[model samples]
Target: MTEYHGNVHVGGPVQTHELPQLMITKVAVGPMDNNAYLLRCRQTDEQVLIDAANEAGTLLRVIGSGGLARVITTHRHGDHWQALAEVVERTGATTVAGRYDAEGIDVPTDELLDDGDRIGVGQSTLEVIHLVGHTPGSIALLYDDPKGPPHLFTGDSLFPGGVGNTRGNAENFTSLINDVEAKLFARLPDETWVYPGHGADTTLGKERPSLPEWRARGW
Candidate 1:
């Protein structure tokens, strides 16, 4: 049986937070307890939905009556996109995914993102960081917050306890750890917020010290 946090539920109240010019709304969905995020631009109200994981009706309601401008799939994982087709078809939102993972997804991708690509979210934008290993094209979105620490949408590339599963392969694990340390830990500050594809949120500061342990354990 899948365990879920107390806050994870259908029709759950959205957890909202302000990040400079962007407003983030997070909701947990699906049997796997995938987290779907709705990022709205404060200046223009243009919104983007990340990983419409499951429960299409709940996601549709979460977007409210305004609808969405684009739906971004974090990777090619089926669970991460169980609701993608429905949500996009219903809202007519443009679909975006990493260039390497686009062909694997069932939905047609409107935009192919690469590392250093900037996705405009009203006045602000999200920087794409393509992290390899768990999937060939797993990407994370970074938002630099002027008022506070930066925010990262890591998808399944990262989680609270450690990096996402690498199919128990040493090479894959090495690749993920290296990319995460170099691209994320080295580049971003410790206060950066990590919102993963599943489970509760965690901070880079909290997880940084455990890097060596994760390496030794070979997860």
Candidate 2:
């Protein structure tokens, strides 16, 4: 396979990164360029879908006949779940979202997550980290690989350049930045890989130096 640079466009080819026990396939969907991740466990063949953003047909095609075990909505954002209901209906995948944002989504959340909760994917597991401000119930998932570097799936709370947009609310921005700094930057190593809800992927080390700049700009 070609090198996975984590760069994808709405109509472009999907990108995939394989690990010892997991395989992560990322595709750009919807006009907003939302990114949906398909995580499959090599050990158990169980799969999970992150943010069924849009284009149900394409997503279902990618899912194939195997279907999915669970579908996790990153937040309550409309763009993040345009295809959620359909995907769940077709696959019978358990719905998961943050505890606080659960009510905002149209579909019922079968699993409500909080900080420090663990989601099982067959034999593999993902640790949830609740991030406030970008939306009260925003979350980021951590997959700490024993053989290699760690991987993070940040819904809308984090991105490559700075943190996610807080819609000009000073309090929200402050809360978001603080949580990102304390919960994410302060804990994870520089080598951790970050996968955002949209756009390209970035490593924690690459964005660490610019945290101060982001705060100064105050977006």
Candidate 3:
């Protein structure tokens, strides 16, 4: 487990990042241990939840009295949205998903996200980056902080060790790798922080050198 800024707990509130204008909380839920993140804009108190994977009760508790502005699903994968319906119904938060995969989700999408679309979180804005291959509409959110390195929520497209599984399809693997390289690596700085759908977080700097290896392994 990666050491966050504050104390960490399983299926419990964890203050992962705190800045003057932004705050992030993470909780691991469901059998797959999917990570659900609550990103709050401190200045405006508006917030967004990323991947409401499961454990509605825990997620609700973590949300507390804060008003949830939106719930953004990174992809259409079942595991990434097990608790999405419950969460949306309970909070009445608008649900956002990529257009291509929106239809596949059980819940009706309130908004269709596209590449380059900007999502507001209080005073800050998250730039949506559509990285296809993991899913036709898989998207990642990029938060660029003026104070320091930028933050990236990659969903299942990119992980600490390598890219997400291509399901043994060479074309899919190639597409994912190309998107990661063109849309992410070639543009973003190495200091960018990567938060995935499941498991631990990692920095782009730490994973950049392994691109060749990842390609060689054909994952």
Candidate 4:
């Protein structure tokens, strides 16, 4: 709801300090202000970039500071992938995206990720969960640590107050709703933190209370 610099909207600044050991920093990009995340494994200095978008200059600044290892796309949205080639060219890091989105970027995704797949950055590992509603190959990244609240990075699928807009044949709103309710909501702990592609960062518990409202409103 809070728009910063035209495209970047933020409900709040990321709690990067909270995950100090992981050294995770999320940078907002594009006209929609999509988020591209930079995560560094504090112990080994390994890093990864997630969802590279319009803010290449800014993203590079963060990556340069932290040191980048790989680039990973969450879905096929042009806003999220357009600046990716630049990112790859600059960082020399391999790119990973869902098979469907990979072709659009013209880079053979070094790894085609699917549900239950794991992506590791130094010591921290992320679990890939495919939530195929907004796009056929849409995915979310789930990171749960013993010391901190679990985090879910939902790409263009689920947001703070609503779900992503389904503009293509690849989407089925009802099915997406079902998956969010039965799969994501049912499985994740109530205290889990959700950092969506756009809008604010919210908690599973905070958002779950309004599932019925969203369903009733036809989202």
Give Cα-based local distance difference scores for all models. Answer: 0.88, 0.93, 0.89, 0.76
Q: Give the TM-score of candidate 2.
A: 0.99
Report lDDT (Cα) of residue 35, candidate 1.
89
Error of 2 at 99 (Å): 0.2
* Evaluation by lDDT, superior candidate among 1 and 2: 2
lDDT, model 4: 0.76
TM-scores, one per candidate: 0.94, 0.99, 0.95, 0.87
Superposed model 1: Cα runs more than 4 Å off = 1-7
What are the per-residue Cα lDDT tens digits for candidate 4 across 36-106?
77778878999988888776777787787555778889988788876788888888888888766666665
Query: Count of backbone clashes for each model?
Result: 0, 0, 0, 0
On lDDT, the stronger of 1 and 3 is: 3
> Which 10 consecutive residues of model 3 have the lowest summed lDDT?
1-10
Candidate 2: worst-modelled 10 consecutive residues by lDDT: 58-67
- Model 3, TM vs. native: 0.95
lDDT of 1: 0.88
* Residue 205, model 2, lDDT: 98
